[model samples]
Target chain A: MQKSTQAGFWKKNQRALAPWFFMAPGIIMFLVYVIYPIFQSIGISFYEWDGLGPKTYVGLQNYRDLLDDDSFYTSLKNNVIWLVLYLLAIPAGLAVALFLNQTVAGIRLYKSLFFFPFVISQVVVGLIFTWFYAPGFGILPHVINFFTGTPTAILADDKYATYGVIAAGLWPQTAYCMILYLTGLNNISPDQVEAARMDNAKGWSMLWHIIIPQLRPATFIALVVTVIGALRSFDLISVMTVGGPFGSTRVLSYFMYEQSLSEYGTAMGYGAAIAVVLFAIMLVFISLFIVRMLSQERNA
Target chain B: MFPKPIAQSGPWTQRAYKTLLPIALVLWLLPLIGIAITSIRPGSDLASGNYFGMPSGFAGWENYSSVFKNSNIGYYILNSFRVTIPTVIGAVGLSCLTGYALAVYKFKGNLAVFFMFVAGNFVPFQILAIPVRDLTLHMGLYNTMTGLVLFHIAFQTGFCTLFMRNFMKALPFALIESARVEGVSEFRIFWHIILPLVRPAMAALAVLIFTFIWNDYFWATVMAQSVDVRPVTAGMNELKGQYKVAWELISAAAIVAALPPVAMFFLMQKHFIAGLTLGATKG
Candidate 1:
């Protein structure tokens, strides 16, 4: 009688239980690979070890060492520069989107062709830009030479290397932003646009007072993705300069990898410390994003 | 429509606009065009400083073939497919269930769990790299395609869950409610009723994930080390080190490596754009 009653109980609550069962593999895998690793990295940051040796509890030495580290500051500064310059993509993209938002023949093809850069791998983007910035044969150098009578190897110079890499990154990022804005523009109500036109709104005033307000959601998403992409800027730095020209191009992501994994960089603990700092910074923005998304969810 | 279509302009202005379109496109694609020409140019042209000029002879076949023959590019391409395909399938399949659960049921932690996935998806990868690599090494899966695929599936789940949950929430609840009223089980409702309805969302996510995994360079470098398992992104980097001055061959290989994601984007442009601009259109 007990067994039959238990089976009956199982049959009744099975719907609620089944979701947990279905969610098991994904959640478990995510916890192990993504969630658990976050704490593990935090723990590792407190230790002193060259990945192969016994880990010694160094208690905050890594943090203390980071205080005096010059490269860390340079990387942080370059990251700030990257963040600031990368934002230009949003406005530039919106401009392009507005330019292309018309009923011209084959405009769809034109827009897609413009967006071609974003779809290609960053490795290729890096290569293309590296080629473009190559000294004599590169187009940029020739243009500079034509103006100044001297060719410049931008990537080989410490002062300009980071900016050069950032430019390469902006090419694709701008395309991505443009596509987002184009889609956002597509859904704008034409009746509202006509209503505004009847009110004598035109050109920049129309965009600012009428159109910009409507594009708030797209702007928010653009800002979120752009910030994340800027912080995670590693592949371009790796391919274009390898954080070179005396490490002027180093960003936090590349620097972390260098310290943790490279032959000359066996300081695993120090690397983890850097990683933790980056995570903390990202967490601040992520928290804001979550709060905003939650408010949206509540409203919905 | 937002800019007021150019056709609404006077005829002279419209004629000028028509003439300017091709010119603007050429300027926009100039760098890519240069690269394409350079890729097909003979080695003699680059050596002789004839970069922008027409190639004296087209060596496209030779350069492209040499990239395949002289390097492990074939193996690298295969590795990319192996990593990308499984990741898309795993992440999408898992999210379909998680999404369905969150959308159909009113659990206590639903919003919190949903937000966690959304937040996790946007975090920097470095935060997860060290420990993920360590864990992979501990599991004896490091430097293996299986290790990379597993991590990708897990990490990608965060993004996939956000997308899937949003999509599933947009679905009508009446269908599920009616099915339940007819005495259908939740599992059967998901499998028989909800799954088919979300096929477009699944396709969108699949193509997006495929492009993302295929283009991933950082994790591929972090997890896999051996040429036997390295994907094209890392492989191309290695080839760059070896063939430093072989611009023709290097450019050919780079273009070849970039083709899959580019092709996927063009083929699924509508769904891809829809997925990317999900929240952008709505007020």
Candidate 2:
């Protein structure tokens, strides 16, 4: 009788066990690659070592060195600049999306053409922008010469290099945001717009009050992606400038990479510290987003 | 409709709109158009500072052939496929089960696990870089395609899980509940009922992941060191360094490297957009 009861219990609990079984592979992989490494990196930040040799724990020394590091400040400042300027993509994207939201002959092709930049790899984007901003013979310089009569090399100039790279980033990022907003526009309820129109809402007032509200979700996502992309701005900087014109364009991501992996860099511990700091900053936003999502899940 | 379609407007306004569309598109795509033209331009034209003018001759074949001959671009493209296909399959397959579990089962840690996936997805890659590299090295997977694929699969699980769980959540629970009441096994119900329902989501994710993993530059650079394992993005960068003045060949290589994702985007545009806009519209 006890054996039969045991068999029955096993049969009943089998379904519940299935999820755990299903989850095992993905969970184990995540733990190995992502979750565990996060703590390991944080731990590595306390030790000083080149990647090759034995790690020596010198607690807080690496962080202490970062306090006096000029490059860190430069990277931090540029990151702030990137974060601020990159957000322009949201508004710029909304404008383009709104303009393209109209139905006409061959509008689909036009939309796809506009989105072409985003689909291409960023290395290609970087190359394209590098050529665009190339000195003397490049189109931008020629255009600047046409207007200003004194064409400056935009990328070679320390003041403009970071901004130039940011603009290149914006080209693709704006298109990405535009696609998101376009999708959002497709889902806007016609009833709401018609009702608003009946209430004499039109032009900027209609956009500000009605359309914008409907686009909040897209805007939120745009903001999130843009912020993350800006903070993680490495490829464009690496390809276009290599954080050049005296490393003026060095954002934290690139700085961390340069410190850890570059030919001149051997300070893995210091690089880990920078990575930890970046992670900490991102963690704040991640927590907020999670909180919002959790609340939404609860309400749902 | 919100902006009011041009079809509803006056004939003059419609004519004006029609004329404006091509001009705006041309201006918007100027850089890409320029690159496409430059890719086909003969090296002599760029040497002569004739960048803005018509090419001296179309060297499209020569440029393309040189890129293939001079570099390991073909190998890099293969590497990209190797990394991307496995990651898409592994990540998406894992998510299906996890999503089903979160959606169907009334487990205690369901929400917590779901949130963990969502949160982890958003963190910076650099945070995981050193330790991931170390772990990969320890496992003797470093600098191998397997290392890159493993990391991508694990990292992408966070995203796939979020998408899968959300999609599964919207599915009608009645099917699962009824199956359970009918003494149908949970595993069978998930496999037969819930899995079929989420095929659209899977298709969408597959296409999106294909594009993402294909275009990934950062992890490709960080994880893989040698040309044999390096993906197209990093390979292209290295090629750019080698062929400094060979603009035509460089352009050809860049175009070649970009082709797969662009093709994927065009072919799977509907599913791609559907996947991207999954949460945006509802929120």
Candidate 3:
């Protein structure tokens, strides 16, 4: 009788309850590690904690300090520079993808080889660029020598450090965008292309109107990942320069790491404040992304 | 079809395309190719300022052997596996459940929950760093492989869940509906019916996540401090500081550090691209 009662109960409520049951582990894990920490970090931003001992509420003092801090502005400006320059990968990738979108012999191997840099860790990429940019016996300096008759330590120069780092970052990011565009190109409806061609929509107009319109999904993802990549760029900077040569290379992310985690300081609250700013910048794009995904979900 | 295929163009255009193809690839991958060459160059060649010249001899074995012998990199690589394999299993396994729930069920707030995971996946890592570190410390798993594994599993679920839920949603709903008519329990339905179908996606997620976890550097530095637990990426940083100009050895180690992900990506090229480009073509 008890078993039948239980079965009956499940029959009536399983639809509603089973989802929660299934979601329990994933939801809990996400909450504990991801969602909850976002809020916790925001709350910490309003306090003055050094990652340990008692926390004292500071009521936006960290943000206030950030306003007066020149390094903070420098980092923020550098981040803007990164955001602007990093978008180059999209077009560069599309160009390459366009060039390579043919079935020549061994093209498959060529495609994978082109995407190779994205497969390696960023540390390796950073190291590679460091070697390339090294003043002595580096290929980059060798190339520059033809024009300037001298080798320049690009990473050591204040004017060039962030740009150099962005260049290193673009190596993988362009590969990433190329892969997306390659798949996007693959899925392009040949009928539409032929139709457009028949209508005399050739070359740039075809790409701008007919082709790019159909590639919207790939474009969206490329933009999203590229934006996030620009914001969270730490490994390359860390490996190449360590925000060095007068801290010209620090972005808000690296600045936060320096304030909170590095041996230089333990100002957890201050770090959280920096993170909150970065988070706020990300939230704008995140909401746009979420809204797009939601609309797609509804349509599905 | 899009670019007025070079084959349809004049023979000169086709000839030019073929000629330029390899030249473009060489220019694109120049940085990587440089490092690969550097990895094989002997220390004597580098010290003698033969950086870009043809190597006097291939010392790949010597450089790699020296890296292994003089460093804790072997232990670090082992630690990486200890953290990565479990993270792949834990994250992917948990996401299957979450994905099924979101995909198969009709529940209120499902969209909200699903979006939460998607948004959380893209959040800046710094926001989670302090709290996650503290949480691990509280659990007495700080600076241990288990702690890194646990955090990665949780963090990765965000992306994995997004991937998995979409994959599961694409599966035909009728399979589950028919099974439901026979009154098989929900768990049994998930296990016996849905699991088999999603195995391909699970494999894709497995390889992708393995590469992700293996190539992770930021979290490795944030979580593990000692060489006893440091993954190869973080350990490489220490070696970077110690051996300031052993470019050959450093390049060899970088290649070693990158080998797993590179090999995984090559072996599972199709699956890796599928996993990355799943939602890309639909729109």
Candidate 4:
């Protein structure tokens, strides 16, 4: 009788309760690690905590300090630069994908080889680029020397350090965008292309009008990934410059790590404040993306 | 079909296209090629300033062996596997449920919850660094493999759920409805029907997550500090410091650090691309 009662209860409430039961583990884990930490980090930004001992609430002092801090502005400016320059990967990737869209002998191997850099870790990419810019022995410096008569170490120069890092970053990012566009190109309708061709559409006009319109989904995704990749530009910076040569290479993400975790200082609150600013920037993009996804969800 | 096919173009255009292909590839991969060549070059060649020349001799064996012998890289790699494998299994397993719930069920706040995961997945790691570290410390799992694994599994669920939900959404809903009409329990349906069908997605998520966790450097530095818990990416930094200007050894070590993910990509190329380009072709 008890078993039948239990079964009856489950049978009746299953539709409402089953979803929660299914989601319990993921929801709990996401809350503990990801969702809760976001708010906690924001809360931490207001306190003067060195990661240990009692936390003293300092109100807006951390943000106030950030306002006065030159490093904050520098990091913020470099972050803007990163955001602007990183978008180049989308067009560059599209170009490569277009060029390699042809089918010929061994083209499959060529496509994979072209997409190779994205597979390696940023740490390895940083090291490789460091060697490439290694003043005397690096290939890039040698090439620059041939042209400019001086082997300028790009990473060492304040004006070029962030650009140098961004270039290394672009290598993999472009590969990523290329693959996206390649896949997008593959899914394009042959019928429409043939129709356009019959109407005497070819070359640049054809591409701008027909090909690009169909690549909207691919372009949107590429833009989103590239933007986020720019904001999360910590790994490459951490490995390559560590915000060095007068801290010219410091993005907000790297600056946060420097303030909170590095051996130089352990100002947890300050780091949290920086992170909040970065999060605020990311939230703008995230909101835009979520808004679009919500509309799609409704349509679906 | 766009841009006019090479076969339909003039012979000159065809030859030009063929020649440009290899040259473009070489130039694009020049940095990687340099590292690969440097990894095998003898120390004498680098010291003698033959940086870009043919190697004096094949010293790949010596350099790679010495990296293993003289460093904690081997141990770090083992640690990476311990952390990454469990993360792949845990994240994928958990998301299979979360994704199914979101995809198969129609309920209030469903889209809200789905968007939450999507948003959370894109947030910068710095935002979560302090509290996650604090949480791990509070649980006495800080600097331990368990701490890192738990955090990765949780964090990865966001992306996995997004992927899995979208994938499950595309499946015909009729299967679930018919099974439900027969009074098949939700759990049994998920296990016996949904699980079997989602194997391809599971494989895709597995390889993608494996590569992601393996190549993760920031979290490796943040959560796990001890020698026993440090992964290969963090260990590569230490190797860099120790081998300053020893280009050959550093090159070999970087290659070693990157080998797993590179191998994963090559082995599961199709699935990796599918996972990455999940939303590229459609909304």
lDDT of 2: 0.88
Error of 4 at B138 (Å): 0.9
TM-score of 1: 0.98
Q: DockQ of all candidates, in order?
A: 0.77, 0.76, 0.83, 0.86
Model 4 off-target regions past 4 Å?
A: none
Superior by TM-score: candidate 3 or candidate 4: 4
lDDT of 1 by residue, A1-300 (tens): 999999888788877687787677878887888888888889999999898889999999999998899999998899899999999999999998998888888989999999888888899999999999999678899989999998989999999999999999998999999998998898888899999999989999999988988888899899899998999999999999999999899988889989997658788899999999888888888888888888888888
TM-score of each: 0.98, 0.98, 0.98, 0.99
Model 3 lDDT tens row, A135-174: 8867998788888987778999998999999999999999
Worst 10 residues of 4 chain B by lDDT: B1-10
The clash count for each model shown is 0, 0, 0, 0
lDDT of 2 by residue, B1-283 (tens): 6788878889999998889888988888888888888899999888888998988898999999988987899999999999999999999999998878877777888888888788788878887888888788999999998989999999899899989988998888887888888988777888899888999999999988998899888899888989889999999899989988677788888899999989998998889888877787875
Best by DockQ: 4
Question: Can you give the lDDT of residue B2 in candidate 2?
Answer: 73
Per-candidate local distance difference test: 0.89, 0.88, 0.92, 0.93
Per DockQ, what order, best first? Answer: 4, 3, 1, 2
Give me the runs in candidate 3 sitting further than 4 Å from their true place.
none
Model 1 local distance difference test score: 0.89
DockQ, prediction 2:
0.76
DockQ of 3: 0.83
Candidate 1 stretches greater than 4 Å from native = A1-3
Tens digits of per-residue lDDT, candidate 1, B38-67, equal: 889999999999988879998999999999
Show model 2 residue runs off by greater than 4 Å. Answer: A1-7
